[model samples]
Target: MARSIKNPKKAKRKNKGSKKGDGSSSSNSVPSLPVKVWQPGVDKIEEGEELQCDPSAYNSLHAFHIGWPCLSFDVVRDSLGLIRTDFPHTVYCVAGTQAEKASWNSIGIFKISNISGKRRDLVPPKATDNESDMDSDSSDSDEDGEVQNGGSAAPVFQLRKVLHEGCVNRIRAMPQNPHISASWADTGHVQVWDFSSHLNALAESETEVSRGASTVSNQTPLVKFSGHKDEGYAIDWSPLVSGRLVSGDCKNSIHLWEPTSGTTWIIDTNPFLGHAASVEDLQWSPTEVDVFASCSVDGNIAVWDIRLGKAPAASIKAHNADVNVLSWNGLASCMLASGSDDGTFSIRDLRLLKDGDSVVAHFEYHKHPITSIEWSPHEASTLAVSSSDNQLTVWDLSLERDEEEEAEFKAKTREQVNAPSDLPPQLLFVHQGQKDLKELHWHSQIPGMLMSTAADGFNILMPSNIETALPSNDA
Candidate 1:
């Protein structure tokens, strides 16, 4: 029987769910189970269908659950120097209830622990027999993993609910300090949290609660910033900057927060504002602390240097479509990549932001809209792009392109005209095993390893071309 929970929409629908997965490695050098191109930890991808139980087929129904469905979450594995192993491990994500009766403000810290021990025998079968062969042949360094509905064992997750006063749009884990993190929500609030203590407290208790019945944190957020209004969609913590944060909202407002005297935190009285529409995402340069980049529905991207005061240090019209997301290259301070709603992504040099033509490379691979992009922290030239079509592709930007191609790349980035006739053959691997992927991130320590979460569930994975996915010995 399912354990009972506190106040929520109570409904008894004869529904079905699957067992959790224990994300682990196989003992045999080449496991026998069939594998797909992508490996997912737990998939909660909801496939909607209008049902007709009775004759009145006009009533469209939706899946109902008392549990707080996952809205968003962050990986705890980003702690610097984290070692990758098949040993038991744990991870966490920030979550919020999608239920109508619940406060849009209720945010939860969700945990999945003991991600070890695979039940190979009980694991569900694969979509095809060749799947196992594909798994055995792929390089371990590159994940290019896969998932099945009834097979993989999932980590047990525990959760704690907290009050945010509005809907949460994003949660970011602090890379410098494993215990510190922050969230941006509809309440126009940026809340900072220190989770070390909470994690320590649950070390002894097997606190794996059901998907949504998360345990409430006894402590409150360490700090909160309430400078913006309306719903906020972007919030990013600087990897190199200690206690530095940047958050954006639907109000077209962006606030930079810093640690203040005593025990408090403060947001600049004036927000950095320039975008004509809602800011979709923001990222801090991995190599520069004060420098960061922001994308917006205004079809532009702007770079800011906090030291330069409130104005954008440089800005450029980046796309014909809304620039939904942008990320800085981990190895190059001035290198940036942006994804748009029109199913395209571009790579550019921030040094040429003032120039109308700044895109160094443009990729039109996904037929569906783009979601997010990340450069490999280990390989300065590698890029990963996720899309709405349930696919992930890792490209090796360092691949040897012909002199003519190189010349054309520079020409396009310089002149901002004549789109490239073809994508340089830097393409490495393509992953098509998951549906509705929401986000993707690389392992902190592992060079090519990656993790992604979808509406179906979350996945711990990477691509298969480990050799090309990283900086080669010859590169």
Candidate 2:
């Protein structure tokens, strides 16, 4: 059930830390005491404030959840950090670092709170006896002996935190820990924070931690690569290998770093540059760690073999406009999708043979710049896309048929005359008829369900079965 609460005075008080001129102060007299100042931005806004605004208005004003209103400026740089959401109050992670100089400085978890909403009070109803009985069959052994499976485990919802005080261009979650790695567009060097220890300390101290403290004193950074004259736009941790990470910058260069040794490898060492313009996004193949793909502002997509260290192994002139995002299907290693500023999205099959390595599936639907694309982890062929046109679309890549095969199938279709629909019916889920979709993510635990956030500050969790082909209004 969804509910909204209104409290204007409380909303204002919640935002007091964000008010201009609020600053953090420390005293030598109390070295252990930490002073926290609420920096004004969107992430700090109470959920009640977000729920009160018109969804459409929220979308237009806060597109990308970027800039002053969205408060998404803070970047999380270390292994442990905290993000607050509307429900369950707070969420945190423990992060691992690759820095070698500070091997003893492990990442610490941190927490921040001032969340307000009825959703925070929501708890799943107590389980019935039959449900408990069913859960007993799936018991797992733990330190506390057998544990029931069907009972509610810890809540899993998390909101992204503004890790730094500047604009965040790239964010990557560490594979080993709950920690996240981020690079700021404004700051030149990378920083890491331990969110787990911070959260634990915050729980004990019952206070929020300061952002710019000497928190990473004991952390480890594998390597710190320098030489990019422009802002770094993307950073990705190799899922297949620990301590190996890659980053791309606005100058159209890709840098590979070994976090522990601080060794740097400039992959683009030749004139056959991967992209003509800045590399907007890059993702390592979930299946093949040695392989990865990069999309650029030049409207091109290049697939690279990390070992070659020079030119891309395969290249495709993907979109008419700059490609902003790339997402790999978790279930299929060779399947991927790209979103572009031209308001179109293309799906590619890495396994398909091309004249010179081309995209397999090309989809153009959004009329405005497509900002984000996400592939469902649970469903192999399902994909979710969001754009600046204030729209979110769920695409089924399995429905795509090759042109030649489609033609042959059409000839047979004429003979049959009454063929069943080849396109599986789709469930177009909408939230209050508003569509300024900025980001959408499928539940890691739940199949056929996902959540979406809009620039308008409206976040919704909707199940795919919400709109089935039923005669009645409710499915």
- Give per-residue CA lDDT, model 1, range 115-190, as digits (tens): 4321122212443768765543431111212221123344455665666555456778776665676876555677
Q: Which residue runs of candidate 2 sit more than 4 Å off their true CA positions? A: 1-165, 199-226, 261-272, 356-358, 399-437, 446-460, 464-475
TM per candidate: 0.69, 0.56
RMSD of each: 12.3, 16.4
Candidate 2, residue 462: Cα displacement in angstroms equals: 3.2
- Give model 2's TM-score versus the native structure: 0.56
Stretches > 4 Å off in candidate 1: 1-71, 77-97, 104-164, 202-208, 261-263, 354-356, 400-424, 467-475
**Span of ten consecutive residues with least summed lDDT in model 2:** 10-19
lDDT of 2 by residue, 257-367 (tens): 555532333333232258888887778888887887889888888888878866899888888888888888878877878988877788777777365554767765566
Candidates' C-alpha lDDT: 0.59, 0.46
